[model samples]
Target: MSDTSALPRPLLEPPAPQPNPGASGPWTGLRTFATAPFRARAWKEFAYLIIVFVLGCLATAYLFVMVGGSLYLSVLVIGVPVLAAVILGGRVWGRIYRVLGTVLLNAELPEPPPFTFRPGPIGWLRSAFTDRTSWRALLFLLLEAALGMVVGYLVLMVVALTALVTVSPVLWAWKDPHNVDARGVSHHSMVQFGDYYIETWPRVLAFAAIGVLGCFLLPWLFRGVCFLHRVLAAWLLTPTRRDRALTELRESRRAAVDDATATLRRLERDLHDGTQARLVGIAMALGRAEERIATGGDAEELIAQARTSSKEALTELRELVRGIHPPALDLGLGPALETLAARCAIPVELRVLLPVRPSPAIEAIAYFSVAELLTNVVKHAAANRIWVAVLPTGSDALAVSVRDNGQGGALQPADASGEAVVAGGLSGLAQRARGVDGSLFVDSPVGGPTVVTLVLPLAGPQ
Candidate 1:
């Protein structure tokens, strides 16, 4: 005995007609097939093939002359320079192909970093001689020259034949005033069968239909050729792995230098404003005390004032040093995190599970990153309890997870305090982690839990 209410129910009215998903249904497929010849992508690819074919021919001639002439002139004194020029020209041709790919095929290829040659002809020639990218580009041009000529000529001939045949019905009668073939059969068209020429209107119409079908398939042929060209471009035009690594290394070095500069500036500002000002007051107070003693007046009050100012200055100075390199980090990351957990306003459940100690630099980054996370939680999370855990992610990595039960959102959110997020006097703990080739991940949603994790290499940035 089953419940009918829970079993099933059917609608009283038929469902509305849904739009076809472009790949379903005979009608939709037929419509796409009919209209594919006129689509923008098909036309663009065809235009690209035509342009490539023309450029390929010109490039073929230029490369043949320059390469052959340079080789033939190798025994002469000017051969080296001529060869260098040809190599540089290959790079220029590479740029042209990249541009054409962008305009016609809507592909954006990555460009290699520019060469930095020394100030001399020898240096310029040396750069061209050792350039991997230029050599590859030259090879790409050669392949394009050969294949482009073949594909272009073939597609062009097919196009011409189809165009002529498609309009055969309209011009068949005008081809001859009598509308007859050489057989003198009246109403005959130019087409010939096995034993007899086509001599009827229906046969002429059928020939035109075949031409129309060919026109329909021409776009697909164009697409196939362009697809091959795309593969070739991607393989040769983009930077090699070494080039990409060099680029990333340059960027990371710049970021690290910028971070260090900002840190120094901040420390200078803090010393001038807080510790330096306090020390200056201490000096003034001691001077006043000396003058009072010389005049046989009371000096104890001024002396006490100077003592207070000196203590405050010493404390501020100590804090600035700790900000640079925390004393607790010298012991280990575990002890440093424990000290942070003790200082946080919220109750924290802390855990450390590492079998081996990491380098001092990595420990410092992990320490500072955790400290920053705890600070954000106290300032904005409005939470009652927090959790901190330090552990090894793998043989090569150390990971720290700081989580809080609070009103959750990403650690960084776009809001009215955009300057606070992007300006000076704000913390860049995330950037510090990245300086060591580390990563930070944040998992915070709008509710009651937010977790931020920092992963650093155990050995240091590679």
Candidate 2:
């Protein structure tokens, strides 16, 4: 009989999107460390540390055994120098470990103390000895060495035990070896099973199974030791708060520089297109008017030339002013983009979905990006159809995209090509789009179709 109540029921609505906690900073580091490749690389480093530690311990033990109590005298003579060397070595090792850990674990490590101008190598060595981090790393190394020794002994013991157990039946059957009884007695005979002796195949199979089980557990035991190594590494390799802050500051500065360069290029392009071009046109018109009067042409002809030149100058001046700041943008990006799309040579489809207008700066960048993208499409793309989409991206930004169905292959060359060329008209547009803290990316193949996307920060209505 079917039980309707026992069956699971579907929800009426889809579940809301869960927030990603590890997408930002430090948590991201931890998440990266947990991935398979990073974990494997960390284990490789741990293995190398174990090897170095074992060698160091062996050397130390050899020196101690040879000198005995006189080792104290040797320490008094060489102890200071050895300690200094170990500390210096630790500093160097710590720096290398820091770089490796950052790459593998994506976590920052404590910054090494600033270097000072020391008189000689000895002075520099003394400074390294005084550094607290150097001492800590040395202590860590020593602990690792001790732990490695213990683990090595345990591994040997397990191997020996497994070997002995696996061979016990053979030893008893072939050599007739004496064995310990439950009572305080030694016997040279083997126990008999039903139809066979205990030292037979059945007993041998039992011992082999136990040995195989122990062998299988060996990797788990090694993993536990490796986990301890990870703990030590995490403690000694994580960066100090100050270093992390400095790193963030450097990244921010780089982003700002890129933004500034983009802005400068946009300003340069506007000056060239607006003020410079207008001045040039005015100069040409005035030259023609002067030539007409100087040639002793009729008064009506000269007057007519003057009037045409004056009208052209006025038009150029208005265009120059518009280039500096377009009034279309004040109407909002939707209307501005609509006006742009209407002017495109190719058919354009624009999609805009936003409840509120973005900031003026964001709008300007978006508008210019779309304008440049359409210009490229009309000039070189040979596109029959174009699509532009604008939408609010989450709560913090606006997204804009232009797509075209044309012969693609629009990538900028390494030296100079396509829209990225310095002399290319679209270069100014690309620069304008990059200004005002926006990113531009193009995906175009050789056959057909191209898509350009831009993302800009959105503050609020101007």
Best by lDDT: 1
In model 2, where do residues sit more than 4 Å from their true spots? Answer: 1-49, 52-91, 98-205, 213-326, 343-349, 369-389, 393-457, 460-462
Candidate maximizing TM-score: 1
Q: What is the C-alpha lDDT profile of model 1 across 129-239, one tens digit per residue?
A: 888888888999999897777778788788889998898887787875344545666654576665565557888888899999988888888878887887888789888
Q: Runs in model 1 with CA error above 4 Å?
A: 1-34, 171-207, 291-297, 331-355, 369-393, 398-434, 439-455
Candidate models: Cα lDDT each: 0.78, 0.61
Q: Candidate 2: minimum summed lDDT over ten consecutive residues — where?
A: 4-13
lDDT (tens digit, per residue) of candidate 2 on 1-462: 111112211111122346776567866755553353335654454454455456547634633543343434445866555555555556565665556446544444556544453678678667756766666666655665566566655655775787666666776678886546556466553543443345446776686678766654554555566556556656764545565555545554565577668767876786687656656665665677678668975456545655665676577666655655567998999999999989888889989877778888777767766877788788878889998988766777776877888887665342543233212443344444444444455556555566666666687321
Locate the minimum summed-lDDT window of 10 residues in model 1. Answer: 4-13
Task: Give lDDT for model 2.
Answer: 0.61
Q: Residue 111 of candidate 1: its Cα lDDT?
A: 88
Please state the error at residue 233 of candidate 1 in Å: 1.8
